[model samples]
Target: MSCLTARTGRQRQRYEGHLRLVSGCIPYKFEKSVGGSNCSTEKDLLVLMISSPSRDDLVFPKGGWEDDETMSEAACREAWEEAGVKGVLGETPLGDWEFRSKSKQNSCSLQGGCRGFMFAMEVTEELDSWPEQANYGRKWLTIEEAYRACRYDWMREALKKFVTALPESRENDTIKELEERPLRPISEVEHQMPSQGCFGSHPSIQQLAA
Candidate 1:
């Protein structure tokens, strides 16, 4: 069995007023294009999405932002638990959106409303199995496919921010860059990185450049 396990219950869940604080991420990576070394064009970009056990639709990995961790760490944790993948977590958030929780069983104390923060994850490692593998099946989709598959407008907006921040035309945007960095959980590295809000500095993407 995998040593990693998903967190259960919401004992450490954090909230503000009536809205629960939640964190999630759009996990993305680049595949080899026609040229090989450099990833060129939008088609090379692939974002990971996970299936919800309670719903037929797919969603990015996310959950309650526990009081013990920063929102960025919470976002990375969700991606690790739900999607079974890890990479360089962006220092900044793609954005925050207020939306209703789709599953009451999974919601925090605030009924169905949630104030969610999202970050862009540059996927560095893809595991053979994960903590929530039985609960959430993961799939990678191209940017265009992900847009159509997005069930919520906010998720789509997060994705828009991700692509805008790192368009394919940008120089030195390659899978090699992220892969060069050592792999470590966000918890271990969070101290060295800046703690950012929904709106912060230019996003630091951890990708195949992972």
Candidate 2:
């Protein structure tokens, strides 16, 4: 069932030192042209972006990594609550970004610093109404428009990584590919984060907050 209410309060919010850890995704879907015709290329892929209630610019759905839920769960919940969409989240994150938040308690070493992890979601369903639908207006944009609409340097950079990581955007070498194992997952965060470790996805103590 879909949640009708958005979660609130920072009481259970998790923090690594002074920086708040946030999670979100670039929700995307494949489509044909406005007519019921098949897409010739991958150019028809669309990304969903939501309006920031406090700003004129659009932003991907994101929110706090509360103590109770896994980072991936938080990311998925934020997308559903804010943008009214649900989909499969990529195994690896698109990228991590440090940005400043307008909220006094969140930032990227500026005022209130925040460290955010973003993933690519292959959106499967969309709802007519969501928890934050009244505050966040959703729009579907092409990759080019999404890039131009980005309001922050980090957002743009993360978007670039997202594009690069897309399987459709890759070029293959046939001979080299023939020798490689197909089981290997394409992951960028793994090599760059040998020591940092991913924020665990499950198996938490499931602490209850009073």
The CA lDDT of each predicted structure is 0.70, 0.69
Off-target runs (Cα >4 Å) in candidate 2 are: 34-43, 104-111, 170-210
Q: Write the per-residue lDDT of candidate 1 for residues 67-146, one digit (tens) a residue.
A: 99988788877887888887777776777889988866465566878898887877888776777777788878766566
lDDT tens string, model 2, 38-140?
A: 6344446677888777666778889899999988888999988888888877776766877767666343344578889888777888877778777888878
Residue runs of model 1 more than 4 Å from their true location after superposition: 35-43, 104-110, 169-210
Q: Which residue window of length 10 is worst by lDDT in model 2?
A: 188-197
Candidate number with greatest lDDT = 1
Cα lDDT, model 2, residue 63: 88
Candidate 2, pairs of clashing residues: 99-108, 106-112, 107-112, 107-113, 107-114, 108-113, 109-113
